[model samples]
Target: MRFLAHTECFFGKSRYDDLHSALGNTITGTGIALIDTAVVDSAAVRDLLSQVEIHFGNAIPVSAVSVLSEPTYDQLDDLAALVRQSDPSFILAIGGGSLLDLAKGVAVLLENPGLARDYRGMGLVKKELRTMICVPTTAGTGSEATWTASFIDDQTRIKLGINGPNVFPKYALLEPALLVGSPRKVALSAGLDSLVHAVEAVSSPLATPPATALAVKAVALITKHLPVALNSEEEDSWSGVQMGAYLAGLAMLNSPGGIASGVSYPVGTQFHVPHGFAGGIILPYVIDFNTTRGYRGYELLNPEMGSNRTFYQQIEELYGILNVPRNLSEWGATGEPAIRTLRELTLNQRSGSFNYNPIPFDEADLNSLLHLICQAD
Candidate 1:
């Protein structure tokens, strides 16, 4: 059982203020703050920045950058160049997964030579990165707890991850207050993304007992809280989803993702589907496929549903409640041509999710799955 550890996490309702306090006490140098464009103007962000200003009292300057969209290699490189000019001692990333990923890429690029595309694969970063603190405003992607930073290839339009020990953040701040007013669709997609992470981690061939335990608990928490969190403003419900997402991320560090994760890349990059939605939409299908082939890994996720309903049915029912689409067709990734493109792209990308899937998934299996999901509904 191998486990890679990094990122000390602090969780609570308004613990985001702790980031400012930590920075004030420990660091005397300039820092860079990356804010998600969607939430940069929110009162929460404004208050945090104000607190930082008060704490520093002009002794240490912090530059704030607005980040939007899933970063492409070119975009990452451009951002890196801009951030390099500041030469910050640390980086504070506040936003969703995309913004956090952009911050991670920038942190690595500051210490490492070459373009973002150069470190597209695993363990390519040769140097230690600048200290990074991730504060996620969404409950998905688990970017805060993971060592992989995702980016898109500008030329190929393929989604790839820059993975290595250096990619791990120094700290993760999980403040549920940051998630209070997220859009309904955004919250739903993020919650479902965490759900997919837990499901895929438990279904991975490399899953350790510890990882399985974390993933199982994550599944239970997310399943119980996502609906309530989406429909209401209760901090406890949001907190549950947040903790579940973080645990799912930790689980994924030990146990790689499965077919659903592999398929999400192509679907997300090609169809412009949100990553979480892409994975969540395909998860139920993958679960059914695996169960029919006698794979019982998911049975541990929801034992209470029993043999009568099956774990797949439980997830499918949740999808109904969440309004998740049945297949890729809803995202316009339809037709045999699109499926062929996605299959080739998935193979070419060589996502580890394929290798780590609970069942043996070859080209034939991938092709079949693609067709099954891409069929018009």
Candidate 2:
């Protein structure tokens, strides 16, 4: 029954502007704004940033503030350097998972000695981070609500991260309007990432009763609303999906994802595939594999995902509707070399995830899973 989410969140169409009070009251002196360069000019973000400038100007001089945009993957050192140079009092991160993750890395490293590479495992981050306010423009990753942040190791090109209490943001503001302009691929991929989280959270051995409840609801919301939200321009649909993703994130925080993520992280890093797409394509195989082992919670989830079909059936159909890549080969992550890299990384870098899976797996079993996901057609 252990469940924890400390972020104070606000959700609505234009609720991003509500951060004015939080900014004015909490952020004094110089602060840094980490924005997604892709959306810096959008009307919604413009309005949000304008609000920040307006409110924060009254409390502190705005000239000292710094803005960094479009943070990239495998560049944790670069991001941390920027943060060190800025030396801001706080950070306001607005954008997708990458931007928010960069802010988290910076916040943690600013207090702790050494680079992002110094902290890799759970609970290594002991010192309190600078105040961070997360606002997610995309309805994916749920980075705003989670205490973990991931980055690729520049040298080894391995995906690495840290998870602990120190990195959680103090505030999360969700504005569904900001999600309206996401490219179709981005929208579908990100949405499916949340769906994977829901399924994995409930299926994981680490799942508790409270986390399972949240995961079930998240699965229901995603199944019912994601497709509708994709085609319809209604804010309500987007809002439902956004909240669903957030709940799924919370579920995952309590019970980290298992096999699908174990396979996807290495596949994504080695193959240069988007993390969400990698997880999206691999999740159906995981569902099929887990269900065969009498994994719990499908009975509870099937009803919510559409009572007419099994939970796995619903997920497969959702994949078709969303037009996601059906196999790893489509993304060029197949064959012996890709398989070997995936196996090594999964067994080493992502080994922590193995215990959380409902069923036990050895290297041979993992190889079979990779082959299953890498199949053509």
Candidate 3:
């Protein structure tokens, strides 16, 4: 494995010093999580301190350094209050998927308290958390790359993201080459996950102009280079991977993903399927089912979108592009009892996908949806 360091600190406080005062944050504070990738040195800490000082007119205290492999919500309770306790003007997040997820959790934690479960599901909270600047290293998860973070709720054994337009990061620092050394599976899965984000967002219920553009660009980039991703080690593959991944990020910048994602979390965690593959497994079925409602227009939003196939055929073509199995059976999910449960969980997940479906589904629609998934050979 190759290791690289990306630091977010202050070299010149003067740059942001005036900006901070304008925000009326003269006594700003900085929140740091200690789970960074590189060796932590005094130089790094000093630079961070200087940046905070430049903004707040004084050095902010670095309190609550928690270390973990990635981001977690189980860290501290009363997140909003904890941030208020420090009363920092800025929160700097530096780490991988887990850390970025935790930063988002903290962003929520600081605003609200008591059972994080209280805030589960879409658009539950509205108030923004502390000002945050996220710097991503692995290029996977693009967690910093986006506003929401997915964290596992150990109590429920399900992973849920901190949802809300407010949670989108104030800004993210992405260096493409940083993704080169990542594990092959994680890189592929993360890249594919972005495609789902782009697709669902474009076909989503609200289908905003900005979101459609993002999803289209994401599809073009991902389709163009997935083969190179699987086969080549060329240095420029970094550019392909970076472009595809960023396009995925841009996909949800306007609209969030659909039901496949909503229901896949439980299915994936329960069945131990990688989230990306599991979600992708059902994407075509959902699209085909949604066809009853005229989802074809969604595919045309992109200048270089798929062509020549019927909508369902185009969806099948999409699966070929993703390089995952054609059905759950291919992934070893074919027991009668297991398939039954799988169908049920997937039906449950369909609710989250409401925005993108061309038509609304009732219990019977879910039955049809499940039947398609179970027999998708």
Candidate 4:
């Protein structure tokens, strides 16, 4: 019954502009904006950021703006250094998950007085971080709603997550219009990622009733709307995808993810596959794997594709329609040796999700799943 996500969430086409008056004219100090370089460079996003600045007026000045590119753990340290010099009163994170995660790291470092590595796990930060507002330019990752921030440890090639209540953003603005310009590939990948989040959260053993409800609703929305949103110009489809992703994020924040995401992390990071694509590619296999152990979440999903088809079958078909990568080798995780390495890395970097899996799994189960996931189709 334990559920937590304290951020105030706003959803609409242009609701982001409301932040101007939401802060109540407190413009005495510096406001830092951590923006994705590619996103900020776009004409639309550039105009959006400018509007946000205009909304703030002079009460709080966005005195510093940093463009985040390919964020890594080292980047957090560098961002921290910059923040120390600027002394910003608040942080605005605008971009994908990496930028938002980096913003969390920067805010935590500003107040906690330590390196980003110090608070690598849950509940490590004793002090509250500076206020942060997250505006996600992409629909996946759910970084806007979650208390977890992930960073890569380049030395070990492991992506570590910083989890704590202090990491939660004070505000999350979900603007569907911002996602309209996403490349088709990005849209397909991110939409599937959101679907997987809903599935994993609903099926996790730790799921609370409220979280499960959100997960079910998210899954339904994603299943019905994602495919249409991928190639259509209709605003309703895109808006549905946006709201579904946010709900899926909230569900994961309360219940956490399970084996699918756990396996996807190492595979995606090690093989340079986009996280959403990696997760989507492995989703059907994980669903089949869980079915062996009496997992029933799929049964709870609406049986809309067809009465004869299983939920996994419907998703597998969707993967084909979306043209998701079919083989691990396509992403450079080829050969038995590479898969073995991925399996070991997955096991080594468990991310506390193994326990949340409804079925008991160990090295052998993981090995079998990896073989299936990597098999050429």
Candidate 5:
């Protein structure tokens, strides 16, 4: 079994303060802070920025920028250029997956000699990236723990991840307080994204024993806590979901994702669907397809469900509780033409995921899956 070391994680109610204190003492040079626009105006973020200014003082000159969701390659190049002028010692990413991804891309570009597009595939980064500390406000993509940063290629309109060991964040700060006031839809989508990650990781053919263990525990935690985190204001619930998401991300570091992840990229890039929502929506169908073909790996994900209902059914029930749609029709991807387009795009852009999937899903299988995903609920 292969094992990969990941980010050093700090978890708690006020871990951000701890991070600030640690960095303030250690970092004597300039740094760049990327904040998600969604939470830029929040009191928590405001206070966090205030603390950054106070703690760092003159020792570290920090520049803050607001980033939007679903960053593109152009945005990465532009942000890298802006940060290059500062010659930052580190990057502090505060936000959800997209902002965190943007921060990772910027970090890669700062130290690498070429443009962001030059390193779109795996193991292309010859230089170590500047230190990146990811502070995720949401419990979704687990970008803080993962070693890949996804972005859209504006020239081709394709979503590709800049993947390698260099993309891993040096530190991850999981503070549940930051997730307290997120919109229900945003929180649910993010939680479901983590759920899909855990499920897919466990089901991947490349999954090691350690990776499966983490993914299984992540699945259990997400299934139990995501609903509570969404419905209640309890920090513990959010913490549970957040830890689950982080574990899922770590698991996925060793195991590649399956058809659901492959489908998400095309659907998200073409239809403007949120990545997490698109993956979550199609996950159940993918599970069903696998199980019908004699893949029983998912039974381990939620062993507590027993034999009364299949694991996929339980996931569907969770979606019902969360009020997430079952397909991409809501994003205007319903017709046959949409399915064909998504199939071609998924084949071209994300074939690696399919190659690693436990079940060998060919073009016909992909077409079928896309039909299921684009079908009306």
Candidate 6:
């Protein structure tokens, strides 16, 4: 329930200090803003900092800044060292999923090392973090807003995560302006991730009313805004995208997402596709698969689901709004060779995402689902 952003979110300007004040942390942080991004090296954070300096004077006092340069392996090593060394006040991450997730992993591992894998299934971290704040940039992943961190286990090559309320940031900074300038492609891929968040939340086995409500709001927002943002030469309407992304995060915080978002980590790690795109491609197929196979959680929202949309139309509309391919082949994946591996990975996933899928799937069921995604038109 506690997002790193101020629980009472502020719309304009840098509410960073206010968030800090509310959280009562003023100094050291493992901050990773887009400016610190290794993928593209964004200057947006620098510009935002400059403006802050202009308005509030010179000293930009932060605890520490951790740039996101490494993939999974090195990042965890670096994070572990930080906790072992300084014992800093907290970790504040400001980047995309990887960056935010890095912060979460660091915060949790520092405190709980004995039963690390025990925390793997869900709700296991059971401890408080060293303090943390998540400032999301791409408006997807919702890492800043969620309470769990997704990570890969290198040796097993199976996807896994460390979860608990402790992994959730002390605040989730929802700065719509911070998200405004990202390129359309990055925005869209991430937006699609959010759409998946909403859809899966609706049918997710983890369904709770609060989580379901958030997903619906997210779907409505994205359905209305993503296309406009995607096509405009200058997307002055970025706030809609930003809000949509936040709602998706909120939805997942509740329902956690089903198999598509669940299955994506394996695909991302094994196939080398980025997580957003990996998750995006599997979503529609999951919805299609679920339509005939399991209980649609949206039944709780029947009046709005209209028998057609929530059952069928709602899902069809999501794919259209995101403009994604209906199959994995469209995303360049081919054949049935990967199905077994996918099933292996799906079994590894166990709870967080796969458990919430509309239907309970065994190895054969998973293989079938992947085939549908691979072959669907």
Q: Model 6: runs farther than 4 Å from truth?
A: 1-35, 38-43, 50-74, 82-90, 109-127, 233-236, 293-311, 314-322, 330-332, 351-355, 359-364
Residue range 241-322, candidate 5, lDDT tens digits: 9999999888888888888887888888899998889998888888888888998888786575444678978887877888
Count of backbone clashes for each model? 0, 0, 17, 2, 0, 11
Each model's lDDT comes to 0.83, 0.78, 0.58, 0.78, 0.83, 0.64
- Tell me the TM-score of each prediction against the true structure: 0.92, 0.91, 0.69, 0.91, 0.93, 0.78
Which should have the higher lDDT, number 1 or number 4? Answer: 1
What are the per-residue Cα lDDT tens digits for candidate 3 across 81-138? 4655665555666555656666666766666655566667667766765567664444
Q: Which residue pairs clash in candidate 5?
A: none
Q: Pick out the ten consecutive residues of candidate 4 with the lowest summed lDDT.
A: 61-70
Candidate 1 per-residue C-alpha lDDT over 32-141 given as tens digits, one digit per residue, 9 for 90 to 100: 78887778778877766665567666533444556545688888899999989988987878989888898899999999998998998899999877887788999998
- Tens-digit lDDT string for candidate 2 (283-322): 8887787777776457779877657677788787888887
Question: By TM-score, how accurate is candidate 1?
Answer: 0.92
Better of 2 and 5 by lDDT: 5
After superposition, which runs of candidate 5 have C-alpha atoms over 4 Å from their true positions?
13-25, 50-68, 304-308
Residue-level error in angstroms, candidate 3, position 152: 3.6
Q: What TM-score does structure 4 among the candidates reach?
A: 0.91
| Candidate 1: C-alpha lDDT | 0.83
* TM-score of predicted structure 3: 0.69
Tell how far residue 285 is off in model 2, in angstroms.
1.0
Stretches off by above 4 angstroms in model 1 are: 13-25, 51-68, 304-308
Task: Provide the lDDT at 142 for model 6.
Answer: 76
Off by over 4 Å in 2: 13-24, 58-74
C-alpha RMSD of candidate 3: 7.6
